[model samples]
Target: MQEASAINKEHDKPPQITRGFWLTALLILMFIANPLTAFAYFTSPDVIVSVHPKATIGIVYFFGVMSTINFAIAVGIWCWKKWAVYGMYLSVAIAFVINIYLGVGILGALFGLVGGLVIFLTTRNRWQWFN
Candidate 1:
């Protein structure tokens, strides 16, 4: 009877999901940066094009879409959704390619990937908590 009661208690308990310092920091940065950047691109395409001579209004719109997706990914990460990690990886890869296409140079493009690396390192150990 005690064994059965113990199993029942364990089954009834909710799983704990803890976000580490780095993960929390990354999420905060994402939540803040994504929306602001998206807004800038949506509101001021001419300014963005002036800053990046190689970019056009179309490219600015593309970046705005990417930023919106990134914001969604950040929300997913906060909710402990596994697909968010995959989305982050995909977005980083796309950004790297876009940076290179915009003549940002190899080093600059590679630097953009650092966020993805940080996300992978911080969340790799927390895979169990991700649904």
Candidate 2:
């Protein structure tokens, strides 16, 4: 009986960990916002170009592509994939650089990274739960 129990324990999966309320909320917001922003960029390039005339259509399209990738990252996060956190950081850094290039100013570019900080804070404690 002891041998059988030991074998069963070895095969048992670990208990599933919940993402908790704040993380869940953050992921949900990311899911909604990223796609809508991507859609807007894709459907109306003029919206961004009108504001930042210095920005080319290529830049606008790049933002749209980044938004799409962000949405995918959010999905990966929802699935508890560790790579998503790194991707989120990378995306934010890219946006910051692009914002600066588009003349958004350093302050505005820094402000854009707030979401990344929030995401890090929300996920920091739950790192062990992520794969």
lDDT of 2 by residue, 52-101 (tens): 98898899999999989999999999988989999999999999999999
Q: Candidate 2, residue 25: CA error in Å?
A: 1.8
TM-scores for the candidates:
0.87, 0.83
Task: Assess the local accuracy of residue 62 in candidate 2 as a C-alpha lDDT between 0 and 100.
Answer: 94
lDDT of 1 by residue, 1-131 (tens): 99999999999998767898999999999999999999999999999899889999999999999999999999999998999999999999999999999999999999999989999998999998889
- Candidate 1 C-alpha error for residue 131, in Å: 1.4
Q: 127, model 1: CA deviation in Å?
A: 0.6
Residue runs of model 2 more than 4 Å from their true location after superposition: 1-16
Backbone clashes under 3 angstroms, per model: 0, 0
Error of 2 at 54 (Å): 1.7
Supply candidate 1's per-residue lDDT for 12: 95
Best by lDDT: 1
